[model samples]
Target: MSGTDEASAREALRSGDLTIIGRIRSASNATFLCEATCSDEVVHCVYKPVAGEQPLWDFPDGTLAGRELGAYLVSTALGWNIVPYTIIRDGPAGPGMLQRWVDQPGDSDEVEPEGPDLVDICPPESVPPGYLSVLRAYDHVGNDVILVHADDRRLYRMAVFDVIVNNADRKGGHILTGVDNRVYGVDHGVSLHVQDKLRTVLWGWAGKPIDDETLESVAVLGEQLAGPLADQLREHITADEIEALRWRVGALLREPVMPGPDRHRPIPWPAF
Candidate 1:
C-alpha cells in the first residue's frame, strides 16, 4: 500500500465506506487494498475475506473473528498498540477482514518520517532508532517467552489460537508500524495449521544469546502459564491447547533456537 493511497483509503474507511481501488496477491488470499470509512477514522485497510478458488492451504474451520482475535490477543500481550477489529461486511468477493489502518507520520517540522519506506517500516536506517529496536525486542521476546510474563501470557494464548487455526504467515510485513512508533500486526486468516508452519522473521536473534531482562521476562511468563494465564486460555482455547502452548514455551526456554521456517529462509523478507 502506497502512502497516497493509504491517505485516500483512510478517508473512505472513516466514513464506513469501502472502495476497492486495487488488488494484491497474497499467499493466502487475493487481497484488495481498499479505502474504508468508519465512524470516526479513515483507514487504508487490506481486506482479506473468503473468495475465489480456495488456496491449497486454507483452513476449512477458520473464522474471521478467530483470526483477528488471535492477533489482537498477541498484540496486547506484547504491549503493542493493535486496535480491535472485525470482518463486519462481505464484499463481492466474499467475507473480508476489517482492520484499523496504521497511520504513517507525516514529514512535518515536528514529525519527520524517519523510517526508510513509509509503506513498510524496515531496518534501523529507515526507522527512528528506538522504534525498530522496541519492535524487534517485542518480536524476539514474544517468540521466545511464550508463557512467562503477564503480557507474554496473553501472547502465548494468542499463539495457541494461531496454532489451532493453522496460521501459516506471521511474517514481519503483516506487522504494522503505527504513527506513535508502536508496532501492530495484521493478517492471520492462515493460522491454526495442523502442520508446523510457524514462518516468521521475528526470531532472528534466537540461540545467539539470551539477555537477563529477556530471560527473566520469560521466566515470569512461564510461571504465569500455570496460573492465571492458564485460566484465561481455558476460557477460549482447549486444555490441550494450553498444554501445547506451555510445551512450546518450555522448548524455546530450554534451547532458544531449534530452527523453524524463518531460521532457514526469508519469512517475508525486506519488511518495511
Candidate 2:
C-alpha cells in the first residue's frame, strides 16, 4: 500500500468495526485474522486480545497488546517503519492490539550460515564474496541452509530497530516479506522490557560500524523519546520501561556499532 493508503488504514484500524474472520493457532497467545471496516474502507488486520495472553514470569500479565502498540510507535518515531501500523482498542475478546495485516505473496526462503562455511542448499559459493550471513537454519527436509540477508537493506534497518527496542523474541518467523518486497517485523509483544533481553535473528552486522544515515535516525529517535513519543508511550508501557528504552537507545548511539551476541544465550529458541 502507498503511504497515504497506509495512513488511512491506520485510521481505519483505530476507528473501524473489527470482525474476527479466523483464529491463528499460536502457542503463546490467541491471535485472530480480522477485517476492519470504516466508511466502506475495508482493511485486513491481526488482533491479539489481552485476555488470551499467556502470563510470563519475566513480563507482567496482560501487557503484551500494549507492547505491540508501543513497538509500532517506536518504529514510526524512528522513521524506520519496520513494524506495521498498530493500535490498542477493545476487540471481541476485550482490550487488545490491532495491527494492519501485511499481505505477502508467500514465505521467502530465509538465508542462514552454518559456522565458518555457508550452508550449500543453494551453493553458497555461487553467492558473491563479502555477503554477510545472518543466521543458520535447517530446511523442512532437514537440510542445512545459510541466509545472506545483507543484500536487503530493510533487514539491516530492522536489526538496528531491534537493538533500540530491546526485542526479546525476534524470531525469524516474525520477519515477513511484503508484496512490495519490504521486510516487516512483527510479534513485538515481548519488547520494550526494563532489562536487556534482545534475542533476534538479524545478527549479521555484529561489531560493524553504524552507518551515518542510521546514526542520524537513531539521534532523531533519541530526541523523540524525550518528547511527544515519550508521552504517547507512557500510556502503554511503564515509566521504568520507557526509561529503559531511552537507555537502550542512548547505549546504541554511544556505541554506534553492532554488538556481538550476549554472553548469555543471544539467539532465540527455534530461531526460524
Candidate 3:
C-alpha cells in the first residue's frame, strides 16, 4: 500500500488493527513497532501502551499516553509540525498512544571523507565551524566525544516547541532526521509536567533571540491554549497541568529568548 497523509494516518491509528511486528527494547517503556492496517493501506506506527508505563514520582500514572497526544496537538497548533501525527487508541496491549513512524535518511549519520558538507560524529575538534555543540560525552574507551547539531532553522523551531511544552526529556536520539530532510521529534510521554522540568540537549540557542516568524507562531499558540485546546487537554491531564502549560507559553512570549539550563538536573542523562 502507498503512504498515507496525516489525516489518513490518524484515522489508521484510531481504527486500524495493530499487529506487533517487533519490540523496541531500548525504550524504558514497553514500546512496539507495529503495522496498522486501516483499509487498503498499511502504515507503520509506534505504540506505547499505558499499561506498560513505569510509575514516576512526579507524573500521575496512566496519563503518559495522553501527554504524548497532547504534545502533538501543541506542535500542530504552533504550525511547527515537529511531532508526528499521533492519537490515543486501543491497541493489542491496551489503550495507548500510536504515532506514525518517521523514516529517516541514512545520510543523517554518514560521514563523508572529503567534502565541505562532511558530517562529523563525536570529538570536539571534528565539529565544523558553524555547527553548535550540544553536549559532551565519553566513549566506552574513555575517549572524549562532543555531540553537536548543525546550525539549522528547524533546530531552532524545535527548541521553541520544547520550551512551550516544558519537555522534561529531550535527548539527541529523539530528534529524527527524516528521509524528506525534515526533523521530527518523538517520545514525548515525559513532557507537559506542571513543574518546571525542561531538560533537553537543544540548549545551543540558549539566551538567543527568537525571530519574528517563530514569535508569531508562539503568539498563535498562546491564543489556542485559552480556547478549544484547553478543553481538549482537560480530558487527558489535570487542570493544574494545563494551566502550567499556559504559564510557559506566556513566559516564552514575553522573553522570546532561550532560557538557560536549570542549575540542578539541567540535561537528560545518557543524552543520546
Candidate 4:
C-alpha cells in the first residue's frame, strides 16, 4: 500500500491504475479521492480533471491543474517540500492533476483523532500562546474572535513560498500538519497569475525579516527561473507569469521581509 522511493512514487502516480474512491464535495472544482495501484502498491491521492474545471473570468479555462503543478515545481525548486508530490495525467474523467494524498498522521493507515489546527479562531482576549494573530473579527453569531496561525517556522516557510508563487487562495483550511510532522500547503490551483492577487490567512509573520536560509533559497529559485524551471513552468503558466515570478523573487531578495497584508483583499473570504 506504500511506495517510498521518489522515482517509484513518481512512476506510480504517472502510470498507476487509478480507481476513483469518492468525491470530496467541499471543493469548488470537481475533486475525486482515488486509490492508485501500481506494481501492486496502493497509494491514495486526489485527482482533479480538466473536463470538470469551472470557467474563471481571469484564468484561462482548464489550466488550473497545470497551475497546481506549477506551484509544486516552485516548491521543489526551493527544496522546501511545501507541496505534495504532484503530476498531470489522463484519468477516467480525462487529463488532470494527480497529487499524493497526505495522511493526517503523515504516513499511517490507522486514523488518529484530529489534533490542534495550524490555524484557528479563538477569543480575542485569549489568542493561544506561541500563536500569532492575523486578524480580529466577528464570527457568525457576532462574538469577537481573532484569526491566528501557529508561530511555527514551517508555516513561515509556507508563507514565504506563497509569496513566491503569488498564491491567491491560501485559506486556513489549506494548511495541513502531516504525519511526518511537516506543515504543508495544498489547493494551489489559482496561483501564478501575472497580476498581484495574494490572499491568505497566514499573515502572522508579516513585516518580519525572512531568515537567511530562506532568502538563500529564494535567490536560488530566482536563478532557476531563467533556465530549466522556467522551461517546465511554461507547460502550465504564461511567459509573463513566469517573468512575474522572477520579479517577485528579486523584490523579496531586495527587501527580505515578510509582506504586510495588501490594502486590497488581504485575506480570503471564510478565513477557515
Model 1: lowest-lDDT 10 consecutive positions: 144-153
Question: Taking the tens digit of each residue's C-alpha lDDT, what string does model 2 give over 60-115?
Answer: 99899989989999999889888988888999999999988887754334643233
| Top candidate, metric lDDT | 4
For candidate 3, what's the RMSD? Answer: 3.1
TM-score of 4: 0.95
lDDT of each: 0.48, 0.82, 0.85, 0.90
Which candidate ranks first by TM-score, i.e. highest?
Answer: 4
Candidate 1, 62-136: lDDT as tens digits: 344344544444334433234334333566465556555556565236776652432233333444422212133
What overall lDDT, based on C-alpha atoms, would model 2 receive against the true structure? 0.82
Evaluate model 2: give its TM-score. 0.87
Q: Candidate 4 overall Cα lDDT vs. reference? A: 0.90
lDDT of 1: 0.48
Model 1 RMSD in Å is 10.3
Name the 10 consecutive residues with the lowest summed lDDT in model 4: 106-115
**What TM-score goes with each of the models?**
0.52, 0.87, 0.91, 0.95
Rank list by TM-score: 4, 3, 2, 1
Q: Is candidate 2 or candidate 3 better by lDDT?
A: 3
Minimum summed lDDT over a 10-residue window in model 2 is located at: 113-122
Off by over 4 Å in 1: 1-21, 25-28, 35-41, 61-65, 82-94, 105-167, 170-172, 209-243, 250-272
